[model samples]
Target: MDRYVSVKDIEQAALSLLPKGARDYYKSGATDEQTLAENKLAFQRLRIRPKCLVGVERCDLRTRALGSEVSMPVGISPTAMQRMAHPEGELANARAAQEAGTIFTLSTIATSSIEEVAKAAPTATKWFQLYIYNDREVTRNLVRRAEIAGFKAIALTVDTPLFGIRRADVRNKFTLPPHLRLANFDGHLSTKIQSTDGGSGLNKYVENLFDKSLTWDEVKWLKSITSLPIIAKGVLRGDDAVKAIEAGCSAILVSNHGARQLDGVPASIEALPEIVEAVKGYNVEVYLDGGVLTGTDVFKAIALGAKMVFVGRPALWGLTVGGQAGVKRMLDIFRTELEYTLQIAGTPTIADITRDMVRHESAYSKL
Candidate 1:
């Protein structure tokens, strides 16, 4: 724990330990990786205006999200495969989420299934990420399984239209190692579907599975099948956030799929203010999931009107480093930094984080 002081420190250590293909796939985002780089750079564009002599004391990081009291406004984002990084995979992630008293999302492309993860970490707050497939029953079955397994919500990711323009996976010819398997569909699909022509392994998988015709109508169909609240992920604009509410979604995760789905679009943080302005009066809660790496980043998002912020690559990096313990350490470190930031930033309670704490960089025309 003393050795890994920064997120980059843990990431570098994990990359050194994992196999070449696995490391590259886990670290690399879409083509040219401009968006991934922009995700971090977006945070740099914000400046925190800490109040002086505010008498901040006894900081409380706890907040309510989706009608549940989470220890913090941070949740684990869904990534494709985790076992590739560590044998424990999503289970380790689940354990960390449970220990932190936060929500953890399981990807549809996860190496571990919902039931398996639920069994592994029963007390963890679970949310399943759904990528609508061509097979309607497959989609229904997944939702049904999650509902039965006690997952609190369904985070339906709608941004990826047949995966991203990830050139790294194409050249690397990335495929799951022999040891790793998609536990949910292993026995169901005899041969794996690979879309190598336009993209590669991932593109092939996206084509074979991702149902392109999916629309807001499907959200209703899904709602009819389960009692869980639907969270629309991958939103970057205010209109879409409003539509999600109109579609009966209880929450909307403001993201660009960790800047993995689209290139040259605005970063998650940059898009936050607009969406917050659009849905300020709506009962819907707003959440974010990109470029979040520090406790201050969480505080900044809260100031910018985000109810909670999700961490994507960092948690996976933890899983890559030392499985469950590594993930827990990552969360713990962030918690420590966040408490430290809140005290120094003069915020004594989560409610004290106001819009004035954030100063948009663009307001200053240095140019």
Candidate 2:
């Protein structure tokens, strides 16, 4: 473990540490995993065309997102049941983000309570990830609670009205560990639907709570609940990007749910430039999160019009290995690799990164 090779190796190590069912649930992405493969392939398709001899020495990777400054243009994407990998769960993640001077997002389905995590990293940039439940009062209460706890933003996940076609989840009939609970819902969730077992127990909650009747007007409802800026997650189409912006979203995160919620959708990286173009002007910011595995991957996404990038599964992998320390180690590896990559590519600073560095196979970087 001391001599690190690649993020894939770290992932494989994490896989070895978990039970078969847990591994399947975390590692497999949607039906046939086509988009899962494409998320990584899209990055490969991007070729960096470097500019040389510019007297490059100092490299600046810091940037801003949602009016909050970031030490680097990256944040942790919301992932459920972090405790399944490590007992400390979201707290470890929050501390890691605090140490890195970036944002940490807590999933609606997270095992740790929002207040608990807020206490864990009191000064870090915190965002509460939301998935509207069938229960309106529940959603409103959670929003109010997040605001009361001083979370800076609210990110509504939109792409997964239905769970992805992941065969492994079905094969395993997964259930949340007995000690864990969806801490955000606490006493708010319906007990009648709590008896089911399959997918993440969180998914059963999803089936019960997700509003089938939710519409564009709902975004305004969320705004009225609390004054925190709303950042919509899961926009892959230009039309959807425009819709999110018009609905008064502060930022549009171009994600395919890390290619875990859909099998055929374009990679988030592939969809970024179009969304960035479609949502032009009007103070809208864009971010990307699917299939990013390295520091070079982060640099590439920013060059392709992503205001910031989110690292999803790799963060989980690092947590599985050594809690906060492993998370720190993994991010350090990516940062070092990216710094080396930027220097070698002759683009020393993040601003030096541009679309010319990437060559698209089609109009898209990778489908």
Candidate 3:
């Protein structure tokens, strides 16, 4: 922790420490990985136009997401099989988010059960990330369990009709270790992944178990089944965002499934502006989560109209490096950097960050 000064350092450390299979599974994106690289590159293309001598003194990073007050505008996004990164897994992530006064989302395919996370971090603001299963009962059961466990919302993933072609997983024959099971499911569904399956076992799992013919009706169905707010995750287009809202989604997560579901889609940041414009005048909140690595990235997304931004891999990197402590450190890093950004950028609070403060690098060329 003392030696690692940045998220990249932590990521490199985790990659060095993790086994080849788990390492590739966590790092690799879809075929060609064009969107994967673009998520970060897009952020770099945006420049912050800082204000000078605005009498900056204190900077506040507090904000609200999904009706809950958070310490900062950054939250944890769901990533599967976190136990591969650390022994404490989702439990550690929940605890870290709790301590940071932020939100933690548990993946549908998590290594820890919904009940386990609730009991472990009883006060954490938790959301359950869900996928509609081919068996409606399975999906229903997961939602019911999440609601019963005190999860605050349902982040319904709508992007992965089929898993993308991650070449790394295919070559590594990535499968969950024998010791860990998908804690939310029972029987074969819990431990379905096998190295003998030839290609990526997780890909095959989604192909066989997840619903492919889902429509906007499923969003209504999800709302019907639970009183929890439905956050439509993986929306990239304004039309889709509008459709999600019309179908009763309470929020839109502007994402391309972390560039894991498709090879050549817009980065979450790049897709954000259109969705924001489309959702204007709606009560629903919009969030982004594909590639957020630093404080400036968070500021840029907020300026572009994301109510909040989330990090998936950065949290994993923290968990891998030092479990709960590592995750907390990672969050602290973001919080501190964001505070500096707020003060230096002449915005003393989250609300002060506006679209005018961020400019595309191309904007300078015309001048």
Candidate with maximal lDDT: 3
For each of the candidates, the C-alpha root-mean-square deviation to the true structure, in angstroms, is 1.8, 2.6, 0.8
Error of 2 at 163 (Å): 1.5
Residues 170-273 of candidate 1: C-alpha lDDT, one tens digit per residue: 78887766566676675534125332344456666666677778888888888888889999999899998888888889998999987767788888998999
Model 3 weakest 10-residue run by lDDT: 192-201
What lDDT tens digits, residue by residue, belong to model 2 across residues 147-248? 888899999998878677678877776767666677876564523223455555445656756887777788888887789999889999888878877887
* Residue range 310-365, candidate 3, lDDT tens digits: 99999999999999999998999999889999999999999999999998999998
Provide TM-scores for the models: 0.96, 0.94, 0.99
Off by over 4 Å in 3: none
lDDT order of candidates, best first? 3, 1, 2
> Residue pairs in steric clash, candidate 1?
195-204
Which candidate's TM-score is highest? 3
lDDT value, residue 245 of candidate 1? 87
